[model samples]
Target: MHAHGGTRSGDAVPGDEELLARLRAAPVLAGPLPEFDPAAAPDSPGPLFAAWLTDALEAGVPEPQTMTLSTADADGEPSARVLILRGIDSADCAFVFASDARARKGRDLAANARAALTWYWPAHGRQIRMAGPVTALGEDAVRRDFLGRSEAARAAAFTGTVSEPLTGTQEYDRAFRAARALVAAEPDRVPDTHTVYRLRAREAEFFQGRADPFHTRVRYVREGRAWTRTLLWP
Candidate 1:
């Protein structure tokens, strides 16, 4: 079928059957991997995550701070988008991200208090998955987070509306210019809708892709203040 705007005669693309066959033929986890030992792993995956993050940075992986943030609506429909990881908190129990309160993600969080985040570094053949309950940070922290952002980022947050279709580029340009002027005139002005969210992970898993069919997965689950580690079959 043609696209909504109508397809051009020469604008051909692969059909669904061709794409399905290609997907079936492609190799999975065809990359080098490091060794993993559940026994040697720490009780909590937090510190190990920090080390892995450092390794990713050292390996020159672009956008190491970027992650796939996944959240489900009240009815259990899932949606995902890429966003920067704000920080790993002091206790290592949670990771944080910032958003506009009126954004779709914010609404998802409001309806469902749980979410998941995943980080993958193809060069290192590593992946981390985390899931747990989410909570909003205090006003003070939200203000600080918003202020610490770049001028453009701060101004965009000031726009407050996220995921809604814009009338046009010109409309956004006008909003951006106004925000920039307001910031220049009143440097401390912060929007009340700027928000930060913390996801306290109840489960964290680290996957090391192996050259062989059998990969290594080490999962950590929180129990009270402590954590339990287990090795899963690849």
Candidate 2:
């Protein structure tokens, strides 16, 4: 249901009363890049990302690997959803949780390998964006990961068809019962719908915000098989 008296085609904007009153707010960085050199950051985007990720964890950013996965259908209709970063390769590539037979994003990936992932930790004022072609991993790899999940999680995974409309609680309960029975019968088998897509990045951009006005943005682009790094104007 729409809230704040918003209409289907139009919505009322919140006024000053809706704004929160805080004594202090975190500062945002501006201006130019700091003394740090992007070229010397790391040999590859993956290692550089690892270093930054470590810092974020040390700083206590929640779910640092949680990123937004963006994909587009064959007709160019775009869709994006948040997905946990399941794994990262030595080559700076990453994998995300998904389902193959559930359609939507999976179908889009099958047709178009191009996709993007964005990770932002507002509390730490850090953001990482990666874009590239995606590749579906082997069934063995998917099964291995699926089997590693807790039984509850595996059961939950089987409860719903992604991006599909739900009828009601009764329908869901029936499906849940069926899924539980199937799993009970064959606990060794991984659900065919559970899959993972590894995103092989062709480009990556890192942003770091500081108290000072000088923010940093480093962009890395792949040329053929080699990566070329550059500093962008923030």
Identify the leading candidate in terms of lDDT. Answer: 1
- lDDT (Cα, tens digit) per residue for candidate 1, span 112-195: 989999999987778999999999999888878888878887777656378888898899988899988888887787887777
| lDDT (Cα, tens digit) per residue for candidate 2, span 100-134 | 55768888888787899998876666788989888
For model 2 the local lDDT of residue 107 reads 81
Candidate lDDT (C-alpha), each: 0.85, 0.76
Worst 10 residues of 2 by lDDT: 22-31
Query: Model 2, stretches more than 4 Å misplaced?
Result: 1-39
- With a 3 Å backbone cut-off (N, CA, C), the pairs that clash in candidate 1 are none
- Model 2: how far residue 36 lies from native, Å: 5.3
